[model samples]
Target: MAIRDDYIKWVILITILYRVGTTNSVCELSVSHGDKLYNFSLASPTWKYPHGVLSEDGFYKIARNGTVLWFQLCDGLIFNHDPPRCFDCQDCGGPSHCGMGCSALVANPLGGYYVCTTIGRSSSTKVNLIDEKNPSMGVVVKISSSGVLTNCSLSVSVFCDSNGLQGPNLLETVGTCDYATVLRHPSGCAKTVSLHGNGLGWFSTLLIIVLCFFVAYLLAGTAYRYFSLGIRGVHAIPHLEVWLSLPHRIQGLFRSLIRRFRRPTQGHRSTYSPVNF
Candidate 1:
């Protein structure tokens, strides 16, 4: 990180040369919250133009809902139209299974599994985390609901996925998410349970609809033809009745015509009759 000449005055005004370590130098910046001032360290092993933006490994941004830590920027709108990202830690605020933080059956950092910190909830609970732009030296401040300011790193165990960079003053950090064991350790917070849906799939729904239609067709023909269901002084569906009685009606009409033709007619019953033709 390199500091430019333009920002020199601001750096001097912001920090008062807090500490000068032999190996790694550290500085302090005061973050204002209303009437109070919160100071966090800005440390780096090497120097670049005296002062600059403290980046990864020395400066980390910390955010949490209850016990779970967060590191990634929740994606913007356009995914399922839901405002919250899948890995959002805000969901873990309350003491309930719904507060398991993230839900992923696998180890996917985005949405594959949930990385939770709790005690005695379960031994098989999965841990999923999101740590992206973690600062190395700078401290991230969090304000409680009562308007009191707090450094989140001091109280919560930051589940980091970085390469060996532990930000200053983090209470406890399980360096890699993989380092967090399932039931191997406890953080006093209880594990949250996740529920999944087992509803019918597309194939099942289609199959059910088809079966219903087939059953309805069979029942309509059989029941309506026999019972008639008090159907009297009203118009009936034409094709329905025809479809029901077509076989019997065709046989009856054919038999009547045959008998008429076989019976003696005017030409056959002629008075002289008996010609030897």
Candidate 2:
């Protein structure tokens, strides 16, 4: 009994291994920026969450859990936190048209923000000018599935007045992503009803074989009679045996019919009569 149990356990272990090795998720992502494009990422955070656990990997990896934001500089530096060059445009695209302010646009890799620049001139003797760069864009996030992983991507675009004053907007766009942990049941593993196995099962199997033999026997008798009618080549031994095994009633009727055919007809000439010279 112990040995039998061990064998069953071994089989189950093999099945589990096969299943796990084949199980994994696929993720993909793409981000569209102003003229240029950049790959978005989910990186570790310096500030801890409500429970002291730093939100790493991404903001919306699981949804409704963390924040998602991404920012890039003109020189090509990407950040998640407020950077020195970024300034807020609270009123420019916010509930209040405050026109200008500062806020957290990219909160990862240190607090960074996007900056929109404006040119100003002095009214003094010589033309003097002051220039300022402010956060002119916001982060757009996208996530999708890849093999065994879910990849999160981000991009930055120029904000128009039509664009809202939000810091991070989860733009749901049709894009590909490579993300991990998006596990799913593998194909061809789901349950389905199949006709191949639906034979009345073993009981039906036995019935089918018996029925086939019965049908073959019935056909063999009919074939024999047709063959014996001078059809020449059909009077084989196998056909004779099949015909002889028919039920008494059928056999009697068949023999009677055969006798009528064998009887001489009026057109027949007697072999014993001598031919006229």
Candidate 3:
């Protein structure tokens, strides 16, 4: 062992990045929500594919109600309109299974070992996952609803017949029902629990609006007062009148004294004037 270890001398290389090969290469996937479009490929093991599953080419874009963490085979043959179901062997003298007499199953690239037991759910609790070597393609989505976890699994192999990818966040199912629910509905919980007090949100919004109005009124009043002061300063400020005592009575007495004492000068007519003592 020592001699072999010495012979196999370890060589060290220095680099900033290293690369690993993954079998997630696929044609294209396009997903759409509303008017937006997004494009993605299944070539990265670390990459999580969003929903666009069987409807579009390789692009999908929208605020999703659910997410697609992994995408397996996406083909037109099996998943064109509806999901696949086993019909010929509904009661074919054996336990129920998927792909019993379906022509599509018979022509599967993988030997008839991997059976399609159920379209949506299965009795078995454990589900097996695979890579591209066996031509197995599937995707699992991890649904988080108010922190509750749920798994949704879909076999893309039956549809695409090609490649797939899986991420750490991808969920694996224990039974077919779990898988079916995940694919059918991605969001685990239909209802969300409130983190804060109920109706507090609306109350807070209303309070903010009221506060805004109050502040506006205060500002307007202050502005009006200041504006009036500014106007008085800009134009001339009016002065109040002041009074002395009994000026009108004194003026009447002086007028009587002047009338009794004064006589005409020369022939000139008396000039009219306010009487003064």
Top of the candidates by TM-score: 2
Question: What is the C-alpha local distance difference test score of candidate 2?
Answer: 0.31
lDDT of 1 at 44: 29
Local error of candidate 2 at 54, Å? 29
Q: Lowest summed-lDDT stretch of 10 residues in model 1?
A: 72-81
Model 2 worst lDDT window (10 residues): 120-129
For each candidate, the alpha-carbon lDDT, in order, equals: 0.32, 0.31, 0.30
lDDT by residue for model 1 over 150-210, one digit each (tens)?
A: 1111122223222333342332333322212111111111222223245688999999999
Question: What's the TM-score of each model vs. the native?
Answer: 0.19, 0.22, 0.19
Using lDDT, give the best candidate's number: 1
Q: Write the per-residue lDDT of candidate 2 for residues 1-277, one digit (tens) a residue.
A: 9999999999999965653332211111123333333322112111222211112221212221232222221111212443233344232223232111211122212254444221100110010001112212222222211123323333323222222122223333223421111111111011123335445788788999999997887567556755664444445335555556667769789999988877665336554578798
Candidate 1 Cα misplacement greater than 4 A, ranges? 1-155, 158-199, 227-277
Question: What's the CA error at residue 221 for candidate 1, in Å?
Answer: 2.4
Q: Taking the tens digit of each residue's C-alpha lDDT, what string does model 3 give over 93-149?
A: 123433322211211112433222222211111222223232123322221111123
CA shift at 175, candidate 1, in angstroms? 23
